[model samples]
Target: MTGWRRRETKREEQIIRVLQEPPEAIDLRGARRWRWADEHWRVWLRRSATGVELFTRWQESDEYRYMLGDDAYQMQLIEILTRATPRDCAAAGFGCTRRMDRACSEPSICSRDPLPAAGVDPHREGPVPGGCDSFYGGDDVRVRFSAGNRHQAVRWSMSLWIDGVRVGAGLRLASSGWWLDDRFFVVPAEGPDEHPAQEYTMGDLVSVIHSVLIHDAALSVTRVLVPGPEEMWTEPWVVRDGDELRVYPDQETSRGPDRTIVLTD
Candidate 1:
């Protein structure tokens, strides 16, 4: 997986640029000449009626079954981690490209990188193991993340990167919501502090998860929807407070009008 990031040669650039344009079958012959025989790509680019579908193509591979085990919820963490509500960007000094959209398209204009902490290197430092955990803490990190399931309640954990790969203390307190747990580090999200009588749904919570992933939500309020919308809510935010790891209210978080989320409001 380490080499996967470095293989972006001129040919890949050409293919990507072309794929970004129209829907058509691309010839692989030209793309091959740019790479060594050992350069392998696990991703597939398929032309669709709308555009292209880029994903790790493993349907026909021997590892297809194993790869299939990847959780859809877990895979979405990356996008969610970098997402923000349109209001968040607006309050942070950005105007709308489209009116009434909940999400913001220009994260760059904002000065804050809300995910847990900032300056997370997208590049991993070491050679990745063939059978590695789903969530990786980069640079022998003080922070940790894990592969977790929404089904399991009361089971999650977290960690903080202190200094130069020295991981700080961690905390674990499971009981609901989506979490990023990789055995060593677990960060659980809190559900909306809605009254039990009011019928808050998983979809509502997932929308909140978008905020949570972006590091733009209440840290103490970390939670996740459990076991397919049964509404078995849990709170799993149990992390030690430190410079490397600090939990607080998202300054950009703005619920509708007259918000009274006791856990937050």
Candidate 2:
């Protein structure tokens, strides 16, 4: 009598062969490998009572380096070659490891700060004390100031440019007490159309305010909240000057004790 049994298919056998052998033992010498598609080095292994594993490393070509920076590529390599325990791997699913997943899911670590919008001044300059740069689409721009002493203040000003023409300015304030005081001014692009959009494309030209300084608190302006553009309702804008103000189309204006605006023709 023959007992009924499910036999492993040829494909499964191939997988088993690749998995059971040590990755270092695989022969990759003299293979016709494509620069982008093929790995320069590889390792294969099988856990004693679990599934299979594969490790691969590719040569860093100029194209790859240009596409993904060196740091990012190195991080990717670290994530792939390192292996987790069988239980950790099994919990994640076949062919997946917890470490790899965690590494992949981690957010980018960058050290940059956001720039003030056009027309506002933070009044004080090095790195925005605690401000960080924001990533919107593919643009990576920032402005920050650092002070020499804990009691000192740092100021930043941004000048806005559209089509290479100066349109408005923004100011940011950073002190020992508060790291960032943001302000903005509205300079209509093409005279304000009813259907305005927030999509920024190449060659659209945007600049920040003019000057930023790092000096004693006595020389720095006090913290003030300025209103941002009318379209950006929730973002507060502040000023560092004490005596001037201006209004824009479809926008309301507010004044504060420590803030002011100086408009130019």
Q: Which prediction has the highest TM-score against the true structure?
A: 1
| Prediction 2 TM-score vs. true | 0.17
> What tens digits encode model 1's per-residue C-alpha lDDT throughout 150-220?
11111113322211121212322122222222121333433444534224335323323211221212232
Q: Estimated TM-score per prediction? A: 0.20, 0.17
- The lDDT values for all models are 0.26, 0.26
Q: What stretches of model 1 exceed 4 Å from their correct place?
A: 1-57, 61-244, 251-265
- Look at candidate 2 and tell me the lDDT of residue 160: 26
